[model samples]
Target: MLDANLSTQLKGYLEKLTQPIELAASLDDGAKSAELESLLQEIASLSGKIAYVRKDDDARKPSFAINRVGSDIGVRFAGIPMGHEFTSLVLALLQVGGHPSKASQDVIEQVRTLRGTGSDGVLRFETYFSLSCQNCPDVVQALNLMSVLNPSIQHVAIDGGLFQQEVEARQVMAVPTVFLNGELFESGRMSLEQIVAKLDTGAADREADKIRHKDSFDVLVVGGGPAGAAAAVYAARKGIRTGVAAERFGGQVLDTMSIENFISVPHTEGPKMAAALEQHVREYDVDIMNLQRAQKLIPAREPGGLIEVQLANGASLKSRTVVVSTGARWRQMNVPGEEQYRNKGVAYCPHCDGPLFKGKRVAVIGGGNSGVEAAIDLAGIVNHVTLIEFDSQLRADDVLQRKLRSLDNVTVITSGQTTEVLGDGHKVNGLVYRDRLGGDSHRIELEGVFVQIGLLPNTEWLKGTLALSPRGEIEIDAYGRTSLPGVFAAGDATTVPYKQIVIAMGEGSKAALSAFDHLIRTSAPVEAAVAA
Candidate 1:
């Protein structure tokens, strides 16, 4: 049904796509020089053609009302679309090109209009990073994907050690600070969701209220979780103008459906813990926005000054210091039923809600350290525990896996794929699966499912605003100062090795102390000004 020439061209494109591009040992490598050059040119041409096809498809795509746009996307673009946030740009361009994606055409068109033509000028982006940071990989990958998506955008990633001079000159405070056209756009862990939201919405204008935008604060906390809550309460009780915001509050603690690890309380739910934290923060007239994500941060112009916190809502808050207590979240499955049962019994933290299913049979779907850990924890209370794994062998740390295997109550289902989650009501009850090697179909009855897959740092909102680790967590000094001054962060957002509520809380307290110290060293004289 296709034209012979077009069909042949399509086949060639497919072949090229299937072939992996040979990367350089160094960017200046010359081993396969000639072949690589030709391949690059061919890739460029193919990309252009693909873009053309996408544009053509966009002409026929369905349109939707504008309000469906997410706030995260709008904030990301206005502040800085760097790091993981850059992935939003790549996806945005793909949407404009009519590539198959979940984003609506209208959103794509808006991005296209904003990006305009980078062809006329060179867009230089430099990110400061290091191998020691676990959160840095996602940032580099996202930015590299953006370059592939848009040829006009030139990107350069520099190791932090190699750029010591430049870092010092720029007050290099972070691992993944991004500069756009030589201007600081963002400098920390920003997510793709926030990036798209920011870009989709036009750049925000500065506020008219000088006090709200420039006045010093009694306490400025960076993160929004348990530790942040504790710090905010302490600071506000001492009569401080307290304000807290993160890409999302409750932190990684929210991903935990239940929490049995915290001392004193035998059990607690994440949402409940978060609600209590929110209530505690609110009790002292503290300014708090749960879903309102931060975009950019800047030190006040006045000496001994305030720090400015910018929000996705286009508003700015002035505080004397900050406390970064944002936490982490569960890693995604990237398989079926993951998104379908997000809040429907498919959970991550057993400490938060393990008691709900006192005798209910459930599946602990993973084989990693977290998986085995969750199985061990759940086996003591749950009716039955099925540890489902897709790998040929379990990869959990030896000791944890040994403990898990020793438990007679835990059953390991290996080399299996959960094709779907079988459920008729609001909650999950069972799963349909396939055995990879045997090529067999099977079903397992379950009352609940806990996915202890992994975790994602909640630093996507800070892309181009601070330094981030390969794991996407914020990079902080021993005292928790981020790449940017007057902007300290802590908890899971930082490059901490282990992610625990107690650790996050401790880091939050440290960040608060540091923020306070910075404030004391820099606070300016207060004037009797009108409340703006």
Candidate 2:
């Protein structure tokens, strides 16, 4: 049941309901069922437009469905939709009750016209998730909204922790593992646009057509992380046409667990911060192209000609100046059995996948801040945590190192390099590591292996086009000027000294200014020649 303060807030939210909704619960005589029934009853009391009913017909107990009074379109929940899923529950209620979604009209139309995969022409999706996962809510809410929009589409969000047997049998070692038509659909975090693109095969062509017709921009940003956002904002403030082509808005920041050193803001979550960045960018005149991966950069032929940036979707965007803030991604161990067992006990995100290994032994591979932090976090949930470092000593801050040493269920191993992930064909059961000084191989039985190695810059596409450092980072000058004419680079993708969110933002802003300066100085002669 919800607390009084929560009830009051929920009541206020429920007041937005324009139509009557019903909760059809399938439960049994168990503690979780009783708790769910109480929660449902309490929710029903919040608004007269809501009703709760019990039915023990579903194969999964302690489950419920949200539906409008007279519609077949609905969403289902196979466990208590609390914790991270609480927002998903609220969104389902509002969406089912006729409240409009915040998604773009084009995306909404795409979802509404989707035909489920299969000969049956119906779609049934099941997503396994965990309460502690920060990435699961987006998948659950997106699917629930899709079900509400299309009558033939039905989605049920299942809690992996509550359904332990199913999680083990299916080898669902990660949160947000989605299945469609009883077959594996996708695993890991996904957005509404991404889900629709997967479900509708022909969507790519239509999207590509739309992107191809976009007008040239004055300043185009090729990423949507902290750096790209800052560049877009700075360019837009100058009253010039700006567009951001990003693989995913927020980039690696979306996978971050906690951020406390952002200056001014003492504490914030990654997703929340990402949302704020997107919202702030939206307030400007900048045009955002999400899920767009830059494939190649072709500089303009002339001094003031438009530069072309090719995309992975066979489309391209032209601009007078470009800011490359493509950012970086988590580096993998790349050892044998790592890729084979990914999402089957080998994961890169401890925050997203840690809860699945509750009470199990796990290994954290790395020696830096991220590895130490992941080990400390996993120690609280898992039965045991073994922190393995390639270096002789941990590189984390003194405070963090001190805190890690104080944990009772944690073990630290220095001068260790992860050799291989050991797993059966189904899932991981152990890991192999070697000592640097002793030159001895050791194998430890564990259920999960969380890789917290460093990051790899997203600069492969620009390899032959511009100057790059030995480590594959884009080479830039102090003013953020890249080797290419009229092109600038920023953030983790560039040769900036430190890699931090705040630093990325400042670098992005500087890059945008440099691009603008380049634009004005270069375009004057071209305009003068044309006038003559």
Candidate 3:
């Protein structure tokens, strides 16, 4: 029978294995080597105990009625178990038993060789991932195979959804993420070749620089919207290292149309504004990445204390400070084909892909101001534009509704809800609908469908990473700073009530300025020290 104390002892051993190592360069080589040897010995002792438990279980479960393989190292997972990581549990149990065959032994040795020879001992790597990720299964399988090849490699898989609280505490933005020696490694799926490359460094090179800092900057903006855009243009023209990653790069201007509100610009569309903004930012060589959701902000541990911004993409960027022009998706259509065909044929904004369907029939599926506006725009480019509505009257302002009605090619279909999208392999071809009043069914033939029903902040992905408003927007102060000190947000995703282009643009500028201020106060000392 398996002893009760075995599981407890194993747990204690694993706790030691995963504890983070604090390094001081000034420490003598004897102390450093001693520390490394201690870590390796702890791992070896744990491995031996786990083997004993596995053999004991095999002898006890003779009937095979309840052949349960147990591990002493246990952590609650957050998510579902259906992903590429499903087999990881079984493999981990197998390794703990110590009955691995000769081939398995060879494989394990090879994996060790690949990791490198070191007196400092084994590094424990545990990864957490979700089944929803299509690419996660491949990653899990590769990791499993690697573990079988080398018993020195300790592997643990955690279901992301199951460990919700733990994930939030760690500020995990995406999966699959590997935590090595208690520090976050890479996120997202990586191939076996990539994994090998990551671990193939020499012992001396394995210790990565834990911090980087910078000092002083010319222009620091707080947002990435119109005002932020204008600020970035000015800053880049002055020529210093400037970079911007917003919740979105385009800001609210990308969601607008007929921008007669802007001075001297006459009538302009959201895409046109976004394009101009993109051109302006790029012309001055400002680094920009859209869809880069910022997570936490912390001062660099190094001298000079530059701020470090972590991203959902598992990337860390250091800047003097930042701009906060991250924007939001308009409320979603919440309809069936909306998610599946997003950026395929069903789009939220017309300006981004409208010209691609020039002269083709399309449907604008909403009655809101944005919906009516999209219908008018599509009518100008396509052979026909069908505006479908579930409500009796259009919700757009009188002026906007009248303009939509006046458009020659636009037809408003009322009291109708989109039932299903009709498509083949490539793109959306048509949609089936039902009339709410009379139970009548109809179908429209179109090449594209634009959903303008409403907007939802893309903040859902920021769960646990940032404090969000009850309505799902990123909550920010008047200065555009979020609850997090070094991070800021702007545009429609913020609690900014007006979903207008002009407002978002101004908010972006505000965010950029806040970020700049934060960096200036934090970065200079660190950069100077690094240079010294």
Candidate 4:
């Protein structure tokens, strides 16, 4: 049951319901079942338009579904949704109870038009998730919203921790693993638009067409991380037509778990910060285009002319000034079998996927702060952890190194180069490494491998087109101007010295101002340009 403070807040939300709703539960006499029943009863007591019923029909025990009265539209939760999934449960209740959703009208209409499962047209979705996963809620809420909008679509959010047998049978080693029509649909965080586009084949083309018809912008910002958001807001505030195109809003920051270094904010989660950034960007007149990837950038033929940026969706957006803030992605170990065993037993985020390997042996492949932190975190849940570092000494802070050494279940190896990832053709079995001092090969058998090496810049697309440093980072001047005139770069993709959220935001603002200066100097009227 919810605490007193939470109950009051949930009661306030229940007041928004305009239609009657019922909770259909399939439970037993187990402790979890009793707890779930109590929770459901309490929820029903809070709202006048809600009712609860018990049934023993569902194969999964301790499960319940929120259904709209006189309709088949419903979304289910297979276990106690107390952690990250609590929001999902609340949203499902409100949406199914006839409370208006905040989703855009176009998205709601698109979800309503999506075809359901197979020939029967009954879309049954199952998502296996863990309570500790920060990314799972997005996937759960998106699917739950889709189910609420389309009666033919039904979704069940299952907790992998509660249902161990199903997790094992499905070989689910990641959070937010989704299945549609009893087959693997996708794994990891997904947005409503992403799910709809996948479900509806023609949705992509229709969206591409819409984006293709948009007007040219005065400032076009690529990427949607902290840097891009800042750049877009700064550019739009100058009374210029600003636009932002991102593959996914939030970018690499979404994968980050805890962020304590941001000034003025003592402690905050990555997802929360990303949401705040997006919200701040929306306060301006910037045209936000999500789920769009910039493939290439074409410089203008003449100075002060339009710069065209081509997208992967075959849409091109022209702008007088361009801000390249494409952030970096997790650096992957390209050793043999690493890709084959990915999601099977290899993971990049210990915060998100560490729970999946509870009581198992795992290896952390790095020596920096991230790797040390991952090894220390995994040591608590996993049976044993082997921290492999390419350097002879750890590069993490002295405190972190001291703490890592204090852990009983952790083993450290230095100057060891990962040669190959050995797997059993399905999941990781071990990893092969060579010691730098002795030049002897060694293999450590482990169930999982968490790679925490570093990040690689997303500047591969801009290669040969702009001035790049030896490390592939965009070379920018003090003013954030790149080799190409009117093209400004910022954040991790640029040679900004430091890769931090606060630094990125400052760099983005600087880049936008630099672009504005470039515009006023070169793209202004003849007399005004000369005077400036």
Candidate 5:
């Protein structure tokens, strides 16, 4: 059943549909058919322009299609579109019911051109997703929009939870795992442009070789997180040529669920914040190169020389100054069975995967702030939470520890080190941990395990090029200046004390100002005189 707020929002969005959107469910004695049927009926009740019907075709059981009154859009969902994927269903209805897609004009044109030699050759997209994955909806929505734009492309989103056999067969270790034409296309969140580019070339590694050129800019900001986006905007405001290179915008922000620490804003969602960041950056004249990953950094041979940045795509960028803001990522325990059961039973983000384990016992691995906080958060959603820590005492704040102690559904275990992840090759069923104080091993039966240890900086790519702290973070001075001249660093990638959105934004501003000062002082007298 739809809630009050969600029902109102869906009704408002559905009002844009000029034509009736028909939802057809194939119910042939499948386990999920009744559930899907109920969901469709509830959705159809939300708006007058929506309708549902039962089809006696030979299509996949429990599958559904969104049609524009009389025509099928070639888009289908082989699993229930609940949880985070509910947005994908709404978007599909809007797009097929005469509402324009949210994708850019270029992406729409690219999808249209994928119709190869008539409709005989079809572009089949199989996206594997979890109900709780926050990033899964983006991938599903993008592929679904492409299918709506071009009839030659057919897209089907498969819930990894429902089809465990297919997931194990395909070895889908992560949510939003996309397979194009029966081949693995990508594994994580990707921009629409990147998806289209990969689909056009039929090769994920082709972009790096195809884009072979040296791009020069006055300031080049690496990473597309909050820090890098702020730096680019600030630099561009000074009327300088600025560019940004990132594998994906939003960085860890995309994984974050509800953000309350950000100043001025009391609360916000991760995707909303990420969209706002991208929108703010676009307001400036910054050249954003999404899906472009920075590979190597070559410092200037001499003073006033150009610093070269090599990309994984084989493209090079030269800039007078560079700002490194590649944020940190979740650190894995690297124990046995960890990799094998990544998405099966082992998950890094508690916010994104917590809902999937509702009413089921789960374990949070760690005793630190993140771990304890995760336990406290999961206590309300799950049936029970087992909190394990490697240290004798919890490293979380007193307030968090007190809050954790107040929860009845949480069990705390100290001096416990994760030994192995327990899974049945298809899904995680339990885990093994060792007692550090006593030479004994213990096991806990849980449906899911959330790794909440700490974060690892995204600075491995700058190993020999820049000075790093013992913890592998970039070392920087107060002005956000790194060890290298004409270079600066900020955000979680650097040795900053705190890792918050507001802190990262301030550091980024500082780094941009420092770089601008360096440029003013290092410029030739003739060029400086012209400005004077």
Candidate 6:
């Protein structure tokens, strides 16, 4: 079922296999099993170094194992690898076939050390994931790479849809839910260091006390997304004490897909861009506090006073200035069934989840740039796409509208108000909407729904502390200065008109410069001289 172009690409990637690899599959005689077997055979046929075999394993009827010939590295998939996870399967094969992991040497050594340390038993990592989760691939790949690095550490990615019973039993409410040795480890994207730390501690507290000591900095950044990373880097370049406090480094950017509007770069993905951002910030002397979320911000009492920033982990930071760039998160549709079927089929990211609905009908909510873009993109992957817009006309660009019109499989519906998401108890089946003009209700049968509404700033914690607009965005001046002295804001969290990465970076730089200027003007002659 691979397309010609995809088949050609797979062939090119398969040619890099340095050693022979064997794929052992145990599948019952059924249509789904037959399709999976055929796909595996096709993949094996692409290279001389790869082969497939059928086996009888009653415990895991539809499971498949990939191993280096004559080596005991056991890497297996318990379900059919399709959708976005198809890339995971490809990467696993390549990794098992002698390709080295992209993880840092430090991380690799840590994994090795973890394996060498007297283990209670085989450390099992069961990651529950959905095909549409943008963050799932990274977690799956990280665990899988660790498994390849050390055989004693086993990793299994269980598709939440296929294994609903286990998901409910474990109370997995989110995708990329990781369970270590049958206990919940983490619920979202976690760095390798964080994972290792979690394993080492094995504490029952999900939010373990991480920060122990009070920290101080000249300029403190309160986020770790593109904007905050840029702010930290810019502040550190001035040779000041810079610290960045982040719940997670990437923020909403981690949920983004292929980015074509990042200025100089012709094309890049979210994970790649996030890594570059982190690496760039690490090149400087900035102290990065990952997994530390700002719980409250207390501005300095005096002009030259130090601002105290409280963290979720009970740690506090005192800084001369604080730049708020906590960024924004995907706005959720509060309609019923939306939350119930979140990962079960109601998805926010078209790029991450579209492939899961391949050859199936799906609907795109909203008619703005994101919605139109999602519909257009999903049209190429799914059987049919319905673009729903609440407005009378589409708010997308002319070029985008023209391109969308050219797509035969896409149907655009304006003045359509989504009322409720319809779903079977286990997964999404369809949705109901009302025609604003006629006041008539209608329902469409589809397997998936992509919500591309807009973004809501992550500034709830700053409420009543910072000057925020009615919509909850931080109000800032042209110079990125907030109402509170020694406090600045930027990025989507601020009143910035555009929310693009490039724009956020520029805004972050402006905020950093503004903070530096404030410091220089307010300091004593000796301190000012030193800063200058």
TM-score of each: 0.47, 0.96, 0.47, 0.96, 0.85, 0.78
Per-residue lDDT for 1-532 in model 1, tens only?
2346744554454343322222111212333333323433333344432211111111111110001022111101211223333343334334323344443354334433445235765445556554333233345444543444443444555554433456556644444556766777675544433444454454223212322454446676756777787777766655556766655556655445457888788887665577577666777867664445666777657755666777766777776666666566667766676666654566655543354455678888789877888888889878899998889988999999888888888889999877877666556778877999999989989867777777777677678777888888888899888887777777766797777787777777677667656655665322311121
Worst 10 residues of 3 by lDDT: 59-68
Which residue pairs show backbone clashes in model 5? 208-313
Look at candidate 6 and give me any clashing residue pairs. Answer: none
Ranked candidates (lDDT, high to low): 2, 4, 5, 6, 1, 3
Whole-model Cα lDDT of every candidate shown, in order: 0.58, 0.92, 0.57, 0.90, 0.84, 0.83
The regions of model 1 sitting more than 4 angstroms off are 1-218, 233-240, 246-285, 288-291, 295-307, 341-362, 368-370, 373-385, 389-410, 414-449, 523-532
Encode model 5's per-residue lDDT on 1-532: one tens digit a residue.
Answer: 6788988898889899988788888876765888888888988998888889888563556778888787657478878888888888888888988898756676688788885433578878899887877788888988888888888888899887777667667766567788877887787776678678866875345545544453577788999999998899888888788888887898889888779989889998788799899999999878887888888999999997788888886678888999999999999999999998887778887765665566779999988888998999889888999999999999999999999999999999999999999987788889999999987999899888999998999988899999999999999999999999989988999999989988998998889888888888886422322363
Measured on C-alpha atoms, candidate 2 has an lDDT of 0.92
Q: Which candidate order results from sorting by TM-score in descending order? A: 4, 2, 5, 6, 3, 1
Tell me the deviation in Å of residue 38 in model 6: 13
lDDT of 3 by residue, 332-443 (tens): 6566666666545665556545654667799988898778878887687679999998898788899999898888888899999888877764567788999999998898
Candidate 2, residues 347-414, lDDT tens digits: the string is 98887888889899999998798999899999988999999999999999988999999999999999
lDDT of 2 at 96: 96
Model 1, C-alpha of 38: deviation from truth (Å): 83
- CA RMSD of each candidate after superposition: 20.8, 2.5, 21.2, 2.2, 4.0, 5.6
Each prediction's total of clashing residue pairs, residues at least 3 apart in sequence or on different chains, is: 62, 0, 45, 0, 1, 0
- The list of candidate 3 runs beyond 4 A from truth reads 1-224, 230-242, 246-258, 267-307, 319-322, 330-334, 339-361, 380-384, 406-410, 425-429, 434-447, 512-532
Give the RMSD in angstroms, all C-alphas superposed, for model 4.
2.2
Q: Model 4 lDDT vs. the true structure?
A: 0.90
Q: Give the better candidate number (2 or 6) by lDDT.
A: 2
Off by over 4 Å in 4: 525-532
- What would the per-residue lDDT of candidate 4 be over residues 1-532, giving only the tens digit for each residue? 7999999999999998988999999998899999999999999999989999997779999999898889887889999998878988899999998888877898899888877647878888999988888899889999999999887888999998889888888999888899998999999888888888788888778888988899888789999999999999888778788999999898888877889999989998888888889999999888999998889999999878999999898988999999999999999989998899889999998888888888899999999999999999999899999999999999999999999999999999999999999988878889999999999999999999999999999988898799999989999999999999999999999999989999999999999989888888887623422353
Number of clashing pairs, model 6? Answer: 0
lDDT of 6 by residue, 1-532 (tens): 6888988999999888887999988888776678778888999999999999988563555668888999877577767777768888889999999988777686687787664234565778888777766678888888888888887788888776666666666655466778877777777677676776566554213333444454567899999998899899888888888899888898878888778988889987787789889999999988887777789999898888899888876668888999999999888879999988886778777765555566789999988888898998889888999999999999999999999999999999999999999987877889999999999999999988889999999999999899899999999999999989999998999998978899999999999989988888886322432655
